[model samples]
Target: MPLLILGLLVWSVPHLFKRLAPEMRAGLGDKFKGVVALLVVAGVVLMVIGYRGAEVVPLWYPPSWTMHLTDLLMLFAVALFGLGNSKSRLRGRLRHPMLLGVITWAVGHLLVNGDLASVVLFGGMLIWAVLSIFAINAREPEWERWQGGSVAGDIRLGVITVVVYAAIAGIHYWIGPSPFPM
Candidate 1:
């Protein structure tokens, strides 16, 4: 639980700092580009280790079906993540693809993991996603229609995301405990 909380704080604070504090972000960006990268990487590593370590204690078990549903939702979450990085129609439609991706990932995990630690981690992420979205929308000016890539590019990104999602799902059991019972 401590680990999970710490990881959440580490992960969310740096991300939010940039969003909420532009001056600090700019100063850091200018003064310590390498340091920022190191901090981000270290923070992510700690978060992953802490999250996996904390999962050992199950606060509660969700219905068996939720795992399957989570798997499906994760596909969309990953796809949104990939699409968020690409200049696709999806990005054009959703001004903030990364926020949408974070929302999807957080919500998906929340459905599958019922433990207190998982709740805190995913819940924090969900809240951050919502707040970040609102902040971006409030700060940025409304722009005209997005200049989406060619239809072919959209198709390519969709295919790539699906493949990446499938590969991750296929390897998940090898990386961690199987979410579904055999």
Candidate 2:
């Protein structure tokens, strides 16, 4: 849908701006962060509105087994998202943990959702994540690996991941069709 496409563009453009046009983004300075945040929020709103309103044009029906894989991937995605911010030893394992989480989430959703709107939403996010990874790597080739985090940090991350995952599942249940397979 047009709104969905527009939402994707609105969300991605601000994110890619700093990577693509460093000078222009830098010119705006820290103040630009607020503007970018607002744009991202608006983009999410548009995407939700578009996705809900779009007609279901199914491309292919996914196998029932895909639901299990989707759940597994979603759990891993949540862990990766928490891993990025946690002071755990594993923090250094991946340079772009949160972006990787996004990729995982998108892939998981794509596995179960074969409709046009879902593809446009999840697939667009996948493309954006890949592009973002490429852009970040091109800009900063060197990475300083993290060190010296204790196991306690990992324990904390695990707890947080569980909480967040439950919250997400709750939201999905509250909204409409639940993510859980019958």
Clashes of each: 0, 0
Model 1 lDDT, full chain set:
0.76
- lDDT for each residue of candidate 2 in 18-106, tens digit (9 for 90 to 100): 99999989999999999999999999999999999999999999999999999889999999988987988899989999999999999
lDDT of each: 0.76, 0.94
TM-score for candidate 2: 0.97
Using all chains and alpha carbons, the TM-scores for the candidates as numbered come to 0.86, 0.97
Model 1 agreement with the true structure over 1-182: per-residue lDDT tens digits:
67666766766777777668877778665666666667667766877777777745678887878888887788788778887667566667767776787898888888888877778788988998898887766666685656767777688788988898878777877798574556
Clashing pairs in 2: none
Give Cα distance to truth, residue 169, candidate 1, Å: 1.4
Clashing pairs in 1: none
